[model samples]
Target: MTMTDSAPVAVTEAAAGPEPAGAARWVTTNDCRIVGRAFMAVSLVLGVGAAAVGVLTRVERLDPSAPDQILGGLNSWFQMWTLYRAAFVLLVVLPLFLGLAMAVVPGKLGADNLAFPRAAQASFWAWLIGSLIVVVSVFAGGGWGAMDGVTAAERDAMTLTLLGAGLVIVALLSGAVNLATTVISLRPAGMSLLQVPLFAWSMLVSAVVWLFTLPVAAANIVVVYADLRGRDPVAFGLPESPGIWGQLDWLVEQPAVYALAVPVLGIAGEIVPDRLGIRLDRRGAAASIIGLFGLLAVGGWSQDYFTAPADHRDELLYVGVGVAAVVVVLAFCGALADAARRGSVRLQEMPSSALAGSALAVVLLAGATFFGALRVIKPFELLERSTTTGVFNAVVAAALIGTAAGVWHWWPEILSRPPSESRGRLAVLLLLAGGVLLAASDVIAGFLGAGDRPFVGDYDSGAVGGLNAVAVAGSVLLVLGLIAAAAAVFETMRPDRPDGPGAGDAAAAGLLRGAGS
Candidate 1:
């Protein structure tokens, strides 16, 4: 019998099974969908907290003269700065994408589930616990760096932070392995890697990049943790300064930062073609462009934590990669545009949150790469300026936009219902606006001579203060946007129907039935 003939029974039986109760349900479940939803939900909550912290940090920047008033002290201010970056990347955007991938990629690959379902569950819980520890440690006077001298208690907190960060990284890596294995090993008969859907291909590429890059970060955390626990702190775990941030900030900066946006390209690739109801023009070229973009984003060699900045950042290779990234993004955008040009240009039918979000994500990524390329020019002197923060903001915005698009597009599999189109569009607009403002203001402030350091907000330009104020406004918008998006997402999550039939059920069952056909 065809898989469809059997789906009702399969879904009914699946739904009728006794459900696990309380903590056991969440902790022991091997369902990728549940695990994925958990990742996305937690990331949204953390995103809001990070945005609020961002607002507070920028508010302090409004009056560089009174830096400590808002956050209470320079140490606290620095803590918020590093904490914001760490939390946003680790606890928010990366997990957001990874979670969605966990839910979506296996089905895309025609697999019944992830190759390592239990590992996916373990990864999520470990990531969640580690994320909490990271946040609590930061608020408890332990963060990536301490501007002032640290007390014994604070030192111990820093150690905890390292451990949490390590766990988070390892969890992410494990999740990546799950995704990569599913993609590589589970495609149906006659479907080569090239024949996979764009989203799946993009995920496979992203998984490889993460495997190559995040381990370096995990290694950095390990080294820092060991040094912090040693008799004497070394160059990395220096007592009372920005040393910790210096060693780890590379994750959120150029080349490496683009790693987070790899899936943005994939999301756009999937959305545009699907929304247009037409095949993408030059599909092979599109796939090649995505792969090239991923290649450029591999940033393991770009970290200069232990070496002089010039030794790595000033090298031809660094500059070439920085500049090449912009071209690669533009190429993918061109491919997308070509597809749209060939397809029927229906305006009313278009403009769904998914399409808008995808378009905005590509634009934001392009802007980010442009800024990154500009920073490589020694004359711009923007490498150590707030322009770095601009690049950071834009890249993150792209990821956020992409994920929003994915959420809307995959709502049936993800949230088990169609998203409110109006609400999704509103969230996309708010997020895009906030992201643009934050990135542009930072870039302009850097040109106006604002340093990269958050505490050094006293740039001579009064305009810099004005820009900081604008960033504060942007942060507020980000918080509101996140709330709107979260409400739209979580409100539809049926608490009582934990095992409702999902969009994936039929596809999963079909794959099982036709495995050897």
Candidate 2:
């Protein structure tokens, strides 16, 4: 547990020069900015694909009577359905934030680069390769849940998918560790943890949460993979059941689902005050709320699949955690509001998309927590219903909004250019509309008795079908928003731009100068 020094670092501002060009530059560069951009670029592209998959999955549910008509088979539909959920969180939202942290956290802390630069690079490549494996294997008859059954080749593909998942988790964990170490061991002189930028502080907390929780998920995959390969099939290895998805579904559920969104608080904290040209009020309390949020989001203990059908959501501790999250979010929002109130501002100035997006992210999160509280209420009986999907839609949409906000707020440090406010606004509005439509429809559908698992022949109501259509529309809007955001990011890297490939170094150098000032 010692920090070993390895690889070259641009420790001085003078080192902010142009980097190598072409394939070798991206493939072999040790710069944290380039490494981070690679992660963001790949993740955003995959996010669009994942969101598209989600749209298709929802469309499949439009006619639940036929179930497999759109996808051709129960197993195929199951693969796409589970793939949409898994990829959206794992391959898209989490990695997008990790990339942003990698690019921005070091500069915020006055550090020259990530504590372990080569490891960051390795983590990016490993994650990318593993993501490809997961996507390919799923299409090749391997996915988290098998609805009907599987052939021998498909079984082998399932093992590959598991391996890819484990690799992806480990890669994300490695990146998180790098960020945590950079924050802890590389702070500038006279700066305490309390004085660190809110976003950096949030990343530290998120890193700890990821370390505590993600390994358990990795362990889940390991056990399931072992059972699948064993001579005798037990509970997890049965190829005909959806047990594997059940065991892993907790990651996308309540307390665990919130883990991927911890950075949303950080992004909001950093952006709101910065936009208002004022320091945050109750900074310490703000940090504490963030920490508490992250703490509640550590859901390694919330898995209930191994036990006999006893739902963990019914537990008092789980219900309390879900309900308390709303208060934490409200407290942070109040702090931001106080800061904004103390600022000398004009209404004509209006809010920037970054500011609006940050605020919207918090709102979406609060709405999600409200739904979570309702779902845990025994009388509501919303457990294992589409309410779970509502929570996920809201949470992931919040994360995406936060991602756009961060990019707009820190375009200089991340994208090496000024962000286009109009494009940013368009993206945020689309995401907001999409999030509301998707989440609200799902919640309403759940209240109408829509089962969590689709295509089991229970959903024949016209109201549910209309809600499903709305969700699909929301998914379409989400995809468009993501595309717009991605385009805005890539525009900064135009071939004619001076800061295209090696621009991140210069950006980092500028951030260091600003921090020193």
Candidate 3:
């Protein structure tokens, strides 16, 4: 057929928009940004909440006898459970959501919308419900026993089991949903796996890590729950074996932290080069990714040795090797940074939030590396018996501070607008002041050997006073950030009329006029 004959005649319909579909309106393929923004909002809240709670726990440790009822009653078990719960939410749940969002949102990704919107929605609801169940059960007061006093051995057993199982379910659902979406829907046409952005690569690796590690963590939680409930956990068959579960928990948690760190590292890799107006060293970036995954796999083996028997020198040696691997990973990070510092890589125009967040994450990773060295290289005798000391408190503080700062630095990008500067500045000041006061309390209390004292009536007056002040200061920071974040959201949604023709408007109009000619 001739070309003209092959071209079908077209009919033009009236240029009317579709009728409103009410609340049941289906999101089109072009709505990836909206889905991504929503996911990020929820993830940020969970992450920040976890960090704030962790910092408070650290402050409490600075002064064990502190009168300020931060989470109520200075009970060790209560504090332990709360901190563990918070850590799980932050490390596991938040990262899972972040991976899913990053997989779907960016323009480089082929996704027009979330790969499986229903699955994404289901994952969110499942995670929320599972988290709530775990939290509420803690306050139920029967299965877990009392907060002020020790629970009956029976109650302790039941409580741990319930919490662990709930967390496992949440982790499994999140990992599966994320992995499916990333593999099936995120890859764009003509883009090879090698060509994917560093962040997306990290997410891909993280999902695989989750697939392997989360099941192990879940198994460990189940066994621990059973042990707590006064049952013989080994009765569970095959995959649920208690001994294997313990080994896997250690394995999973070690790499899991790296999984969280890698994405932030990738974000740094991308942002720094762009901000400095130079091209990133693609080979260096790829090397960093490979080295990170290798280190994560090896570093994970060390957690098992933490509570292993003193005679297990072989286990200790294994841990040392893992530590060495981590050192290598740190070196890779240094290389990446050095490349940026040189003219080899430059960051083009990038958001301030990206710059801040990426910088803070790198700092946090550095701090983690320092502590890992201490824990690994120190004499086993000194490390094993040095529980509940000021030094230990310092390590915890470093981790908490690093994570919190990183989270805050990225808050604006995640929220899609600047948070109220007044509130952000106030939070920064309060965090600094609170950190100082808490550190001071630790010093004073240490001088009095408060660390050796029992949790009862032995009170370090100076420490108690200092901790109370720190708690108050930290609370202010938390409240202010929340208020500012809320205000930013409200302001963004408010309608406003357009001003006179600006650069963006003029450019658009010019394009339209040219098209007419």
Candidate 4:
């Protein structure tokens, strides 16, 4: 008999001897994998939308004087805000849901269902509602991606507060679910923390980070909302004050970047070893974890420099630089190189996911180095002339590209079928070409030029010209590649029936029999 045919018989045989009264309970775990898949699908859509907005922003800056065509009079400033808001929702909200569901699901966690299944259901519903509220806030009578005109300032204020609170609750739920599942459900009799998969470990670390950071973010949002309504939120203090609340606001904002990136970093680490077919090195993994935590702490402290006294600011800058160089830069690079080498040595066949994730990791690491330098050595220089704008753009581009590549690498396994080889080749070509164009643009814009007074101009001239061209081209390529790959995967994974009794009917009957047994 074929494997599909035998699968039904095996399930039926297992079910024929069941005895426990509640053993056959049709629990919420009925569709964990499907739920996980749907979560990932939504995440991809949001990610692509956010990236598209970013590309447009770059294009608008490249040639500001051009007729307001793209995005309907969408200037760079407005696009920046849109990108920021979109990114916050995509990066913060979507990932939280995906990560939580993945953690609590049956196979990953080995749970019959989520620890608090009702809470799990509630979490998903609450997150959906909260996400809609935040997204609607963007388009509530304002222009596309506009936020300034929502007339319900009080309502908007309340919604924002509710949204943040909801996010915190979601984060807490993720932490609880992941922790309980990892400790109680996912761990087989022999599995220990060290034996757990790297991806699971990464999820665990990210959960801890969320546990600590989300409350701060939620509290600050509440305080900000209160202050907006002419209420005295002196408990949190003003931005310049010395109170813990002020410190908390600064604390929440700084680590927010890492809060998003760390999970991605963990995913990269896990994928690299698996794709390469190498055993993950425990020491290297531990070092990477430590480095991530150290950087998170230092980065959190550095946000105070924005309003801090000169001496305190200087000290924080030095600390930040040290952490970046010693902890984040050197440590992560070392771990990545070690993992890559091990994988290359062990695995004869390298999948696209492995290659793409490795490359993207390098790009992000490089961007992080640049960001560190910008923040520490010449903060005033970049801020005064807006020279840092290019750096910011570069960082965002690298991040989005890296994220896309990582997602593509894992798409086949996640979707249960390989994407079309033709589309895969096209994606590779588009990404390479786009990278080349963006590089050329950077060089032409005099990014490396040495001058006391930088000549930053409008999008009509200089680097903006080249940047715009590259941005538009890259965006088109990226969207096309993503859509093609998604279509191919969906097509390939569609159900196929054999010339015999349908598998679903057989499987369903077998399951019922097993339950009755």
lDDT, candidates in the order shown:
0.86, 0.87, 0.44, 0.46
How does residue 302 of candidate 3 score in lDDT? Answer: 45
Candidate 3 Cα misplacement greater than 4 A, ranges = 1-35, 55-59, 65-81, 88-106, 142-185, 225-256, 284-287, 290-318, 342-351, 380-517
Cα lDDT of model 3 by residue, 1-517, tens digit: 6466332323211333353353333233223344344444444454455445645655554555562456566443344434344344333344434533443334446554456655555554555555555444544432222234444543453454357445635644564555446644578777766566655565555555556555655655565465554543343222221232234334322334444454445555555555455666664555455436534543333445336664332355745643654565566567557656774332463334334445544554554444444434545322321122222232233333333333333333233333444444444343333333443444344444443222533444664556445544644454344334434444432222275222233245335323421
Stretches off by above 4 angstroms in model 1 are 1-17, 21-23, 348-350, 495-517
TM-score, predicted candidate 4 vs. hidden true structure: 0.67
Q: What is the lDDT of residue 354 in candidate 4?
A: 37
By descending lDDT, how would the candidates be arranged? Answer: 2, 1, 4, 3
TM-score versus the correct structure, for each prediction: 0.92, 0.93, 0.65, 0.67
Regions more than 4 Å wrong, model 2: 1-19, 495-517
Q: Per-residue lDDT for 1-517 in model 1, tens only?
A: 6455565768876885876877788777888988999999999999999999998998888877767888998888998999889888889988998999988888787786899999999999899999999999988988887887989889889998989999999999999898888888988888888778888889889989989889999888888888999988977798587888888888988898998999999899988888777888777788888888889888878888788745599888999999999999999999889878887667766477988899889989999999999988778878889999999998988898899999888765677555577998999988998899999999998999899995554465778888998998888888888888888889755442446543344355345323411
Give the per-residue lDDT of model 2 (tens digit) for 1-517: 8775653554543475676798889988988988888999999999999989888888888888776777788899899989988998789988999999999999888887899999999999999989999999999999986888888889889889999999999999999999999999999988888788999999999999999889999989988999988976687877778988888999999899999899999999988888777888788889999999999999989898886568677789989998898888888878877877887556786578888899889889989988988988889888788999999999999999998999887766677555577999999999888888999999999999998887763666889999999999999999999999999889864433554543445556457434532
| Predicted model with the maximum lDDT | 2
Number of the candidate with higher lDDT, 2 or 4: 2
RMSD of candidate 4 to the true fold? 8.6
